[model samples]
Target chain A: MGGGKEARRGDVLLSGEGLVRRYDDATVVDVDSIEVRTGEVLAVLGPNGAGKSTLLRLLAALEAPEDGRLLYRGRAVGRDDPELRRTVAAVLQRPYLWRGTVAGNVEFALKARRLSASERRERVRQALQMVDIVDLADVPVDTLSGGEAQRVALARALAVEPEILFLDEPTADLDVSVRRRLLGDLERIVRHAAPAIVLVTHDPGEAFALADRVVVMEGGRIVQAGTPAEIFESPATEFVASFTGAEFMLNGTVSKVDEGTMTVRLESGASLEAAGSAEPGARVRVGYRPEDVVVSLPQSSSTSARNRFDTTVAHLHPRGGLVRLRLEADSLSLEAVITRHAMEELGLQVGTSVVAQVKATALHVFPA
Target chain B: MDVLVDAARQALALLLSGDPYLWGIIARSLQVSGSAVALGLLVGIPIGTWLGLTRFPGRGIAVALVNTGLALPPVVVGLFVYLLLSRQGPFGELGWLYTTSAMIAAQVVLAAPYVAAITLAAVQAVPPELRLQARALGAGRWQALLLHLREARLSLMAAVAAGFGAVISEVGAVMMVGGNVHGETRVITTAIVLETRRGQFATAMALGLILLAIAFAANAFITRVQQAAPRRRRPLTS
Candidate 1:
């Protein structure tokens, strides 16, 4: 890797080589090398405690890795450089606003640079308008609700007009509707501003919706990094499939193997048959997407699907046009997403009996 | 109860009569305590901020020592300062003992730790993210410290108030080091002690009333600050 000759200016805004961060005696983030290109949104997607946020911090230069070289503009620099800080801005998860009016919080970064008062005011107004929160400018930060506060925080970051924007789980704490709305707002802002961005999130949908590229991290290492389509559809690792909620991981053991299909007994003792290579008496893990699982009433119909589990509807919630159901079958828990119209037709309710139907090809089985 | 009433009456009378002697004692008390707390702030705020924000080897021990210093016995501090300035001690040539400087030094020992301890707790109470956010938004180390201090202003003000209150109301250290000499080392606390020992209960009560007023004022000030959303600042009118 002749980094000096190969590195091109304006293509990559920031890069890290051999980054390592540890906490509680565990190396929570250990990336060999990563880069953020200009005018692209790179989303770091991972499950809870997967060190996604730590990677964001390292990339943003907020935390100096114990062992690593952080390079800016293809040149290594001190981690705490004021110039570097000035060029980058971040909106952390559950961001805290300074004790002042919304406008005050927005102007803080500007003030550090000693911008003219008129310039600061103009930028603050523009940022607030960008987030559609101009009316909230005079409101004190503490008085704003969670969604409104998050918008204010975004406005504060945008007001800096930074070269790079780092957003760590920006919408994770928001309500579903609010998160969607904010994501839409962010897409619009990103299009207009076109600054390099590094977004850390736990949801694959969010990464697909808002980022140009997705990097999947697990157990402190980058398992895969590629276009969102590649990550969501053709994930390089099963951990990415399980983490993105694209698939549900359930513990199961093989009951028997006959012909080409393997009968695996789930935690609830219910058996499922899938086209897999696992042998008899072998412990295996099952993975399938909620959208692939069909929720049908018991005795509604008989289908050629090889796997059907007798389940009781434990809970259900609306997810846009679909309804997410949490079904329980004794000792096993499963999730299924079906259309609202189907939900109304089936008349599914909590404690109602339903058999979850899945095609044999949909289940991806792996040795436990 | 009657003795208390009579003492209050005498306190009011002395205050109303424009007595210079009592005023001198009060002024001297303020001078000594104010100087001690000022020095304490100068030395303690930085140390406390460092302790609160940074992680280093033996930090726990340093923090434990600071908290312990919060409850430092004034008499013990006074004895230590006294020995440091005593004729028999090593640095005795400077001769600070039996003087107001000696009282101020001892009180500084008592007050600086209170300032430091409170500041440490206050800085730690502040959200670590605040400092991180500040630094991320182009603030240098000193700027980040200032920003964090502004966020924890309530705790800092409380620390100052506690320091002042601790020193102004303390009697043991100043008595041991300053010797309560009239017109020189005698502050309100020592005067009150002297008056009470001589059975001049009214004078002692009058001095005690002034000291109580100071304490009450300090408490009221802190209460007002704490009650305010963050700090005493007019809304930006631009």
Candidate 2:
């Protein structure tokens, strides 16, 4: 199932081709293509206005796409098809629990599928236990706190034993501690339940922690989709790189290519060599981690370092025990982090000359 | 003051003596209005839910029409019902005019719009997410609709109280449509009007008291149903 691109066409459980959803004149969701197959946790990762929730709604069959076919199990299904709804359940960011007891909320799914009385009770008990909220089963929904309510909502969806589970920012409203615990529970659920999950969240950390495959979206369109390692280590777009906190980005043109390495001349007039297949004359975005660039004084020049730039410490911003130095050259702007001891020992300050060393392999060069 | 005191005493005497005529009128009032409210509920709830939840081009207009109907004058409703059931009118051939059925019909006309509009508001007040949540749980459309109505049970029951209140206390519409016939269409409100016109102030006042008592009782009952923990400690079915 984790064969990446090959899994995409093998057993596509749900797919949307050329899907478009508009609210008035504003297009809220525009997916040229997307698919969720069985046994994979797909994370739609984006910011608040990135239409992640809207895309989840579209895939859950809760909404009708204005310009696409929502194929379920390889057959075209109507947006109002009751059968389709039964196969999938969604827990929205701020889910509305029916005005009832916790058990009743979970029982709702059982009721909808017309399960027998004893069976409903059994399923409700199992679902509540699974979410670790069985003790709150008989408690009124209004009495439950946010975390408890979210757990009950999860139980409600899980009670259905759906083939697909759509959790739209499930822990977006939880406290930090609660969110962490719920994330652990969610991962465990994915492992034990074995249902295809589409978790929608703007938190990249959450996506990387939970999802098997990550789809990065921006401004209502999916910009990148890959494994979490691929996304975090070598983001395909500048937005993905910035979102992942590997924040350094520079516009550069490839000047030379020899073997597997390419020389890129930045707009700032600094040259960097990176191992990439990009052809010469290609405009590309180069990104690297702040910690990847080793900051030291000019006297301690490391000869073995291949990509070393002599730059000045423009400013220092202290963060706890680490000092963030904003570096500047004639045309390059970069930020690097070093310990306070290093700052004290090197006597680095504004306008101080320093050599920034970065390994060529750490530079992520992608065609812009 | 002495005259008023005497009328009150006389009213108590008329009440204690169990006047068959007065009791009969009270019974007729209950039957007609109860039947009307029932009929209204049977037709209004589904329509109101549809009107409240659906998003079509003319939905706002339909909702506006229902809201406007909430303020419809009883006399106007009576006049229309009378015309519709009049011999020369289109539905006049049913021969229900000037009968108890016509009184019930008029009361239903007064009550239905009130019920529908209030139910619409009640159902709308239930958060939109409730339905979405219900559907996400695999509920069919009808089940989801019922769940919304259930969540708004208090308000929907209040709609019933409003509907019954409007129909039970109305005189103008029933008078025009049923002609206030004795031993037939002489409900409490119509009888009160008739007795008052004939200068029987005590009897009219007595009927008014009974009518108020009935309304208070009905509302009390509806309130109990509304306020009582609508969801039982255990689900009634499962």
- Global lDDT for candidate 1? 0.85
Candidate 1: the clashing residue pairs are: none
Write candidate 1's Cα lDDT for A1-368 as tens digits: 34553334348878899999998799999999888987788999988889999988888888889898899877786657766788888888877888889999989888888999999999999999999999988887777777888888888888888888888888878877888888888878875653688899988888889888888899999999999877765555568777766565567888888787888887767677787567778877788778888888888847666777788999999988999999888766778999999999999989999988888767767777
DockQ for each of the predicted structures, in order?
Answer: 0.25, 0.40
lDDT of 1 at A184: 89
Candidate 2, pairs of clashing residues: A268-A331
Give per-residue CA lDDT, model 2, range B36-155, as digits (tens).
Answer: 999999878877988988899989888888888878898998888888999998998999999989888888777888889878888888889888888877888888888888898888
Those runs of model 2 whose alpha carbons end farther than 4 Å from true positions after fitting are: A1-10, A277-284, A294-303, A309-333, A337-356, A366-368, B1-19, B87-93, B213-238
Give one clash count per candidate, in the order shown.
Answer: 0, 1
Residue A31 Cα positional deviation in candidate 2, in Å, after optimal superposition: 2.1
